[model samples]
Target: MEFKNVSVVKEANVYFDGKVTSRTVVFESGEKKTLGFMLEGDYKFNTDAEETMEILGGDMSVQLPGESEYTLYKKGESYVVPANASFEMTVDKYVDYCCSYKK
Candidate 1:
């Protein structure tokens, strides 16, 4: 998505293995999101609020809480995670993603 003339605050310096990292972007409407890239690995994340994660590039296998199977999410696909819930992700390569938080 193209954001025209938007003000962004903060940068996400999250590093799972010091190789995977992300940058934070805040919108003017008070919503926040992160643009990140992940290497091949498994990751666990906890959310404080509801989140919609969009896969921008590459591929990943995701396992949400209570789900028995891992779902595949590729480029242009998205998934929603409930507030206070955690999710697991397995990246097979360098996956680019955008994670937006909802109020």
Candidate 2:
């Protein structure tokens, strides 16, 4: 099964590694109901999807343009980004995760 980028996706300066290995995951695909995964070191997170959920892993801070801002998602935690709002993220270590949408 292939995961389509049903939503606009993009990433910058994203990396992943644990002690002795590493990889780069900057992906985007949208045409069907989908899930996107990415590994980022320290970068900005932006989205325009009606709702976006972060699933899997990461220890980063989420920045909203105004009123609300925070970092979320890791192992069993997740978050939904508000529509029409832009956000950003930063991390100390490599972060891994998947995004899902109903577009």
Tens digits of per-residue lDDT for model 1, 1-103: 6865566556557688665788877777877788889999998989899999999999999999889889999999999999999999899877898999986
Off by over 4 Å in 1: 9-12
Report per-prediction Cα RMSD to one decimal.
Answer: 1.5, 7.2
Clashes of each: 1, 3
In model 2, the worst 10-residue window by lDDT is 17-26
Model 1 TM-score is 0.90
TM-score of each: 0.90, 0.50
lDDT of 2 by residue, 1-103 (tens): 3333434334333334322122223235432222334444455545666555554454556665674656555666666766666667665554555555445
Please name the candidate that would achieve the greatest lDDT relative to the true structure. Answer: 1
